[model samples]
Target: MMKKWLIVIVFSLVALFLAACSDDGDKASGGKSDGDTVNLDFWVFGSTGYQELVDEYMEENPNVKITINEGEMNDMHNNLFTSISAGSGAPDIAQIEVSQVEKFLQAKDQFHNLNDYGAEDVAENFLDWKWAQAQTVDGEFQIGLPTDIGPTTMFYRIDVIEAAGLPTDREELAAEIDTWEAYYEAAKKVKEETGKYMTDTPQLVYNAIRDQQDLQYFNEDDELIMEDTVKEAYDFTTKMIEEDLIGQNELWTPEWGTAMAEGTYATMPGAPGWMVANVKGNAPDASGNWDIASIPEGAGNWGGSFLTVPKESEYPQEAYDFISWLTAPEQQLRSFEIAGLFPSTPDVYENEEFLATTDEYFNGAPTAQIFAEAAKSVKTVYMGVNYAIVDTEISTALVNVAVDGADPQAEWDAAIERITSQLERQ
Candidate 1:
């Protein structure tokens, strides 16, 4: 009877130990279990060519499999918000746009700090300001790695530029029209000689000028700085309108496409990501005539994205490794090839392979050099939570003043009032 009781107690203890081990295994690490075939779920939006990179990663590491979930930007952002709120159902890694980064940063605990994995050590690989966009308010947390940047450049019709009696050579043009005043003078000549507008709308001109300033619409504390810098940008754009230097077409409209194809305008201020596709889609007929140049005065970033590892990932280290590799200098070059996803990494800027390549659309101009120079010079601007909303409102005010004959000062006042009320309501 003593032997039988001892056996029962020993077996009971063994059973409890086994149950505890099973529970520990259920808690996955970083998105994978140790010594098991690891599967990671990645969320990416648009054709960033990240999915292709993932396939390459998996091919090399057969034990690690990744599933990609692609969604429209808005939908992806909404899903992220939902997942973060629920504290579950998030992907191992996700791509977040610059416009949406601040939105997510509010829920800082929801993401793994990339700084923890030594992201700053690789900071030299990317443009300074572009890399700065991924940090938290205090810069204590690095949440993401920059994927691509939209450094605004002037995409022009070489023929139209030459016909206007302005220098068509990229170097000469950059030197001669290095200032907004010089650019405006050239625009007047283009209108006089070719009767084609210098730009499609005042908003683009506003963007070119606005991006030059160290600040846009708002200061560091989310305060309005309209009377000085903002007003100057607004007035300059209005001057173009009052002087008849722009075509009256709104952006992304059928008329805008028709104007572009027909050479109704001489230049398009393009953000790299949108420009490459826009030219291919809307102005295909002007293939060899198009070329790119640095924006007058200075360069400003218009769009870009970052890749992040969410806190919900069971495998945070693995997630970081994947993003770091995806955005590594070599992979960035590959992405630039697959899509016009411009490299955020400056390491590739001086690479012969990158500089040697020329696009047939830009008349075989060495565009990589022009873009690289612009990307290098971009000023570090702090984007507040109201960046997007304020940008839209100001664009509307530009149209009103430039197109609808609204008085510039009154329009400026109206914009301020509207934005103030909007912020107050929020």
Candidate 2:
């Protein structure tokens, strides 16, 4: 009887040990599986067919799941700031505009340095200026990849030009208007012949010209550099108003929309995507009459976005892998084909499909080729953290000068004073 009881006790101990080992095995498997099934949150500003692309990626990579959160352009920036400050519930990846990059980089410690994840070496794939926008003060990479870039183009109505008896073909226009000086001359001709304004607003021209400069309101040492290039922008905009090339309506208002539909403006120097969605999408009936051409000054970048990972993310490696894939040249090409975003990768410029593509909305013009060429020559500019504030003050000053007929020199002096004071306070 004692031997039988000892046997039963030994069997029970063996069974208990096996059960404990099974539990440990299950825990280990769960931990490894969690890495494969990482749940990533991503944020972007546009309702510009991003969901379809995300859905396609999920279909291809079933192991990973992405939840996308979108908001208005300005609201997304505000949300990013607020969420990063709290350091909790922040998205793994976020889309940041070029204008806002400097502002976000000021709180540099809040974001994962992409240089640590091997983003620095691949910088050669993007435009040099665009690549620099993602670097921190110490030359550390804070942004992962450039999703899109805006190489400016002049989207004009071919029919309108013909009606106005102006040059219709790209070559003719290019020959007649090789510089901003020639551009204004062509605009005067269009106005006289077609009775339509050449542009929507003087401020739009100002913004486009301002983006072409290599240095904005500040320098590398953070000192205000408010001479030369900036003065040129102000002077050019003032001349546009003095020459009556632009209508007085503010952009984004009902007045602007009405004028666009009514064909009050003959040409618009606009971002590639916006030119499609805003001008062509709003007036689809007017399709086949519009065409795109290179900007007068050869090329310049306007707006684009970079994807960044917050430092507090729980899965940095997974985030980096996903980001690298999404912004890869092939993936960006695919995205551009589906969406109207121009490619940021340098290699895409060589792809025949990218260079030869035509938009039905723009009278079947090979706009992609024109924009790609222009993007190659784009200049890099340093936009300091306070760029938005300074830009706003300068824009307001321009409005006073052009619209309210305020003294050009006096307005510029006051604007410089106000911007300098504001920067000091910050």
Task: Give the TM-score comparing model 1 with the true structure, all chains together.
Answer: 0.92
| Model 2: worst 10 consecutive residues (lDDT sum) | 26-35
- How much is the lDDT of residue 87 in candidate 1? 96
In model 1, the Cα lDDT at residue 133 comes to 81
Candidate 1 residue-wise lDDT, 191-283, digit = tens: 999998998878788877777778776676777667777778888888888788977777677987888888877777645645778777887
RMSD of 2: 4.5
Off by over 4 Å in 2: 1-36
**Model 2, total clashes:** 0
Q: Global lDDT for candidate 2?
A: 0.78
The C-alpha RMSD in Å for every predicted model, in order, reads: 2.3, 4.5
Backbone clashes (count) for model 1: 6
TM-score of 2: 0.88
lDDT of 2 by residue, 279-339 (tens): 8656767877778877777666778899898876766666777778778888878878877
